[model samples]
Target chain A: MDIATQTETAPPPPPPATTEQQRASRGATRPGDRIFLGLSRGSGIVLLVIMAAIAAFLTYRAALALSDNTGNFLTTFEWDANAIPPKFGIAVLAFGTVVSSIIALVIAVPVAVGIALFISHYAPRKLAVPIAYVIDLLAAVPSIVYGLWGALVVAPNLTGFYSWLDTVLGWTGIFEYQGGAPRSLMTVGILLAIMILPIITNVSREVFLQAPKMHEEAALALGATRWEVIRMSVLPFGRSGIISASMLGLGRALGETIAVATVLSPTFLISASLLDPGGGTFAQNIASKFNEASEYGRDALIASGLVLFLITLLVNGAARMIIARRKEYSGANA
Target chain B: MSTTAPTAQAVTPDTLHAARLPRWTSPLVAIGSAAAAVGIGLAAGLHSRVQWGLIAAVLFVIASYVLATAVEGRRQAKDRFATSMIWVTFLLAVIPLASLIWETVERGSKVFSPYFLSHSMGVVADQDPGGGINHAIIGTLQQVALASLIAVPIGLLTAIYLVEYGRGKLAKAVTFFVDVMTGIPSIVAGLFVLSFWILILGFDFSGWAGAMALSILMMPVVVRSTEEMLKLVPNELREASLALGVPKWRTILKVVLPTAIGGITTGVMLAVARIAGETAPVLLLVWVNPFINTNPFDGAQGSLPLYIYQQYAAGSEASYDRAWAAALALIGFIMILNLVARGIARWKAPKTGR
Candidate 1:
């Protein structure tokens, strides 16, 4: 309670004000303080500048591409940037990026939470430690390796599964699969789900471990079952943490390049069926197309990249906000 | 004994012990479910083993819950059901991850060799039997090292600012934007550098361009990790140092940094590992060249991840083998970095309880 209120009313921490307060209270300032302060503050300023520069430069280049476009930048489907009147749009890329990320999130979040809960609550101490460690290592595995694995092993192995889905859910149109290699958004999404599971699990595991012990004990004292104790105490406490973790995973999925590029067969058109082969995400589009693009074509890809940047930015910002707000309510400054 | 017996009798025997499933029931149910699922799969002509597993999993939950509910009651059954689901989820995640590791090792070992490590794909065609990642390894080392050089100090200083002197709007904004920067897609970072350093500055594709993009990704990771490490330093240590008339900067440099150096190194190493695997930025900026180019500032270079991508894109049996081999090497490098970083973290964890 005291911690919560202290943070609530805390004054902003300006250095000079802090120094003056300190001197008035007990200590004296020293000589090299000014230069050191400038250097450190300069570093912080540089970081902000980098952020601003990224946004500014991307915007400038995106505008250059958008101005020469013969089609609506947001709606048109074609990507013929090198033509006399350049015509391109991000509609398909936007649809593919969002859909694939949503698919990843849907498949990943619940399983990630379960794993997190398993590590934090269910597993024995000896097993939990190693499992957690393994998850961390998995999280550190490179995206390209995942891409290679997805392309070579997962895609081929998934053909039967895709056919099953087509038979089971073909009426929905979303699961309709034409006879081909199973290089589709569904495959990309599933691969992304695997790629990001470790990250979400690791983060939510930390949060679940941090859930206050007293509440769980209290629930147990009320004759709650193990699952009941978790539902009453742990899940509520970790909900925000889980949300933020999922958001982080979502950010990654949206921006993932090589994995999608490796797995998904690239086409400009937006496909209604995730199991069918023709869709393109922003990052994958840029990676696959950038090599063959002209200078103007490159700028057009940059414009799509800017959209991806904005999306991930918004996702990460929301996650940070959730974490920050949780601090105020929980009195636990993460 | 007689008095205790009477008291125990006063409490109804049925109330004393609620019905419960036998201890061995879960495994029995799991086996039953698996047999049932396999039988059903065979009869239905289902080809995918994954479908069988899914069917088995669903049967296990249903059979366990039904058996439990019939005997122990609904509440206990619900608990058992949740336990089974959690286990299923964990196994589901683990299977693919283990498969990835297994596949990489099994397939990768077919072509992996010291010779494969030492040679380059410069002259070898995609279908050829002879080639290696020597040039890519060189390019990866140079790019990552250069990225580290650029990122570490700035990230370190920014972290110090946020931890030590930060208090007002500037600090808050920096903190917020640092979080935002953390999520910038690598390809966007590549695009940023493409626009600023290459496109606007008129520089050709080089390892330097890739490094610039990589450092952008690396910086935020470094700052976030270092900030956490710096925050872990006890305030009393700082107070004691300041009370002795040591300057603020000196105290920070001499005391706090020494205390946190292990963690900082681990953070930086982890950041390096992350960027080393990054293919998008390098794919955009470096423009993979199969031959070795030791000079980062000069021209196109090959990186381990980009090499894997290029080989995999080539679409041949030989190229696939090479790709897998390079992937194994890349994973090996990253795993080593991660292991070392975690080792340092464990080793340098504050020695308390003395």
Candidate 2:
């Protein structure tokens, strides 16, 4: 009732036009102001120019590679981008990258949410803060370190699990293991899932912490149990936030180079079986092949990099849009 | 006899409170579930402890739910189940992180020494592996410091523009592109530098090339964080300064910047932490040289991440030890940066910001 009365009596903000008029009247008009503004504005334009240069350069290199190619750039599976004819394509890379990232997302999101919920809702007050801090530290661990851990420890340990999955789901064909080492997409996905867990957990934890206490208390006061209160109050409020956090994680997974490169054995073929030894992602392919590749081959790799760039850009943009829209709605409602 | 009957009738029962389980009951329930899970795992002969752990987690959830349903109600049962699931997930996440840190420290301490920290790999063979990260340290510091020097001012100015003077389409475009830039893969940045600088201009592989790519990655992170910090500087201070007839630039330099400097430093430190561990761009742009090369513009250079990769790729006992040690060193450096940055953030937090 107090909240209701406060809302009822509080005045709304002034309209944009009047605020602009007021600010314009109050603005400082002087040479120093003008010079300072000009410098800062130039810096902003410089950043825009850098972005334009990156896109233009990448596209120009990609076009150079595509123009000389006799093979289809999008569909062919070969990657002999340095041969006399220089045939190459992104079909296998695209499939493996998307599949591996989706696998990582599927495995990470639920576990991350559970950990976030535990930290925010279930943990004792003293334990939650340290746990959150530890998770932050985990997020800052270098990707190369994760790559080393994944290649040496995690991959070997997963051999038994891979065999088990193969026996259990072998008829599905995708999980079939040939008793080789576990340097496959499945391993990379699992490693990536681990690498990104801290990020998703941290973001979701913050959102869960911000769940409005009034609504939660109202639910509890209605004789609802803890789970019932959460279902009625918390999850609904944090759904969009969770989506945005997961998107951020997905962007990271798609662009991850070292971990995937270090974990998987790359070849130029598309295998339906992710447990097999041969798959390549765009970033991994570029990093691994760049040292040995000819000029033509480098351009082809750049072409694939352009695709990865576009994908991550779209994902991060969507996440930002969702967060911004929610901000506006919450602001208006407040 | 009549008095006794009246006294017995006077002692009426107090039945308002509902019956409940004792506090000890929940712990008792957990112990029972654990015992049951161990028995089942043993009976089934599960080879891996992971399988046993998973079984225990599942059984705990089910047992808690069933017990709660019987003793309390359906809703409470669900709540208990969720709590158990969350605990299990938290443990699952902690297991790997602890293992990674523990493994790195355990192996790394075996070879780490002051001598190891001071000597370069100039005289060490790949298999002999008695080398230190001295060269890598020099390379990492010079590259990261150079990258920071290049990125910070530009990022700070851009943030100022966005926070103070931003109005229309141009600012919005800048904001959007910065977001886009944030997601650019380090490998792509490496490739771009490789093309524009090396392939096109015919420059040799060098630390400066790596610095350029790293600065590209560093700028966006710096911009976003600095923007948030600048926004937190209250407008009232600016108004007061302007009201005193101080020039706008002077006011911003004296008042606004000083107010936000602590947070800006934290942001820059965080950005540094991120770029310091970047391996992909360094791998592509600065072709790793095992020996020390001091010049940034002249020749290939060594870096910590590239050192770790090279040592691990060598596949020998001594090489592995060196890799682990260098990795430990890198993690320590990064962790220090993070702790200091967080400390600054906590220490200098604006009174009203929280």
Deviation (Å) of A158 in candidate 2: 0.9
lDDT of 1 at B202: 91
The Cα error of candidate 2 at residue B126, in Å, is: 2.0
| Model 1 lDDT per residue over B119-141, tens place | 99999998887899999999999
Alpha carbon lDDT at A229, candidate 2: 78
Candidate 1 residue pairs in clash (backbone atoms < 3 Å):
A13-B167
Against the hidden true structure, what lDDT does model 1 obtain? 0.90
Question: What is the TM-score (0 to 1) of candidate 2?
Answer: 0.92
Q: How many residue pairs clash in each candidate?
A: 1, 0
Candidate 1 ranges with C-alpha deviation above 4 Å: A1-31, A332-334, B1-12, B38-47, B352-354
Q: Put down candidate 2 lDDT per residue, A1-334, tens digits, no spaces.
A: 1222343345457555654554443334456777888989998999988887778888888889999998898999988998989998899899889988999999999999998998898889999988988888888888889988888888888888889898999899999999877889999999889888987898788778878888889998987777787788988988998998899889899999988888889988998888988889999998888778998898888889888888888898898777667766655423
Whole-model lDDT per candidate? 0.90, 0.86
> How many angstroms is residue A219 displaced in model 1 relative to the true structure, after the best TM-score fit?
1.9
Error of 1 at A112 (Å): 0.8
lDDT value, residue A256 of candidate 1: 97
